[model samples]
Target: MTNPRFDVAGIGNAIVDVLTQTDDAFLEREGLAKGAMTLVDEAQAAAVYDKAGPAMECSGGSAANTIAVMARLGAKCAFMGKVKDDAFGRIFGHDIRSLGVHFDTAAAADGPATANCLVLVTPDAQRTMLTYLGASIHLKPADVDLGVIKDARVTYLEGYLWDPEDAKQAFRTAAAAARDAGREVALSL
Candidate 1:
């Protein structure tokens, strides 16, 4: 109803990615499929992390990255995603906020830690990923701020959000709000 407050509002998982370089033989030995994004549980995520070589951590997630890029290009944007109140979670929050995107989703007090994506890049430049959704999967309808969605010119939803029921509901809520407000909605496949 009021003047739009942001150019875009994005909703999806908040993930931290650890990327490392490995050879094709390493991928085969580890039974990792090349260039595939596989979902793994907490234990599996940990095992992959342990087996990975020295890595660099970065804030990553489909919609989250999109919002970050929008902010960097001088587009006002907001993001909604769930994380845990832990170290990696804090890092993710800090990184996004530092990019000047509005991200006000509260962190879980307990439960699993923030999500982690383990990415291994082979010599062929193929990336094999294993993701543990973790606390990011807890994003719910309540986390979607209708006001923000209404105030944004467009509400963007990420395909990965559908992987989690609560996040899927949140995505739908945001899309509905955008529609109700006569705003545009974009869904990334």
Candidate 2:
């Protein structure tokens, strides 16, 4: 009813990306599917990360990246995603907030650690990804802020959120709130 306060509200997995340069031989040695994104567990993720070469880490995710870019472009944006009260979680929160994106989802106190995506970039610029959903999959409907959704001109949902039932419900809740407020809903496939 009132003027929207934010241009976009995004919801998706909260992930810290660890990127490393590797060769095809490294991928083959690690038994990684070349240029494919694979879902892995925490231990597996750690194992791969331990073996990776010098790397760079940063906040990353489909919707989160979109929101970050929108904020950088001077659009008021808000983001909702799950994270743990761990190092990576702190980095994620700090990175998004520093970019001027509003993010206030509570961190899980006792669950798994924050999520991370290991992106192995080969010489040809092909990316082989190993993603550990971790705490990001713990997002539930309660994490969806109705006020933010209702106050944003558009609510964007990422397809990755559908992988987790709870996150899926949160996405639905956000979509409903935006629709009820006469706001637009966008989905990233």
Candidate 3:
């Protein structure tokens, strides 16, 4: 029986990556660390943005990024991740759907805003990320969909999602569900 779900499903953060090019002195002056994904709170997110110059907002999240590329390569895809039902979240959801990926994860209608990341790209092209999980932290085992697991050929995940304990639990549940469905589970650091 053909599963009526999808070929690829990913569960991770739903973030808008703000990328900007800077020099080494810029990082030191701003008290920012380099080349690591640092978890931040909303205030820190704001602080980073206030300091950063012009940036380009791109739809991103570790697993989400991989799924996006896979989709661009024409792989059938689906993504399950939490987001605030606010503007940024809506835009991320729309972008994925436009690429023909299935997304049915419920958005947190009354929590923190959608997640956002500050991506500082140096002249050397090395990237450092500071993230605020925001509403994406609400992801729990209950948020995972068993049907998506059944239909997808691969279930992909990102390690960064483990920042919040609930989300970590959700990842475990999703992986177990995918295993039960005989689907491949891919994990990326």
Give TM per candidate.
0.91, 0.94, 0.84
Please count the clashing residue pairs in each candidate, in the order shown: 0, 0, 0
- State each model's C-alpha RMSD to the native: 1.7, 1.3, 2.4
* Model 1 score (lDDT): 0.91
Best by TM-score: 2
Candidate 2 lDDT tens digits, 1-189: 899999999999999999999999999998999999999999999999999899988999989999999999999999999999999999999999999999999999988989999999999999999999899989999999999999999999999788778888898899999999999999999
Q: Report, for every candidate in turn, its global Cα lDDT versus the true structure.
A: 0.91, 0.94, 0.84
Model 1, span 19-64: residue lDDT tens: 9998888888888889999999999999878987999888899999
- Those runs of model 3 whose alpha carbons end farther than 4 Å from true positions after fitting are 1-5, 23-25, 34-36
Give the distance in Å from residue 45's predicted Cα in candidate 1 to where it truly belongs: 0.9
Clashes of 1: 0
* lDDT of residue 179 for candidate 3: 84
Instruction: Find the 10 residues in a row with the least total lDDT in model 3.
Output: 1-10
TM-score of 1: 0.91
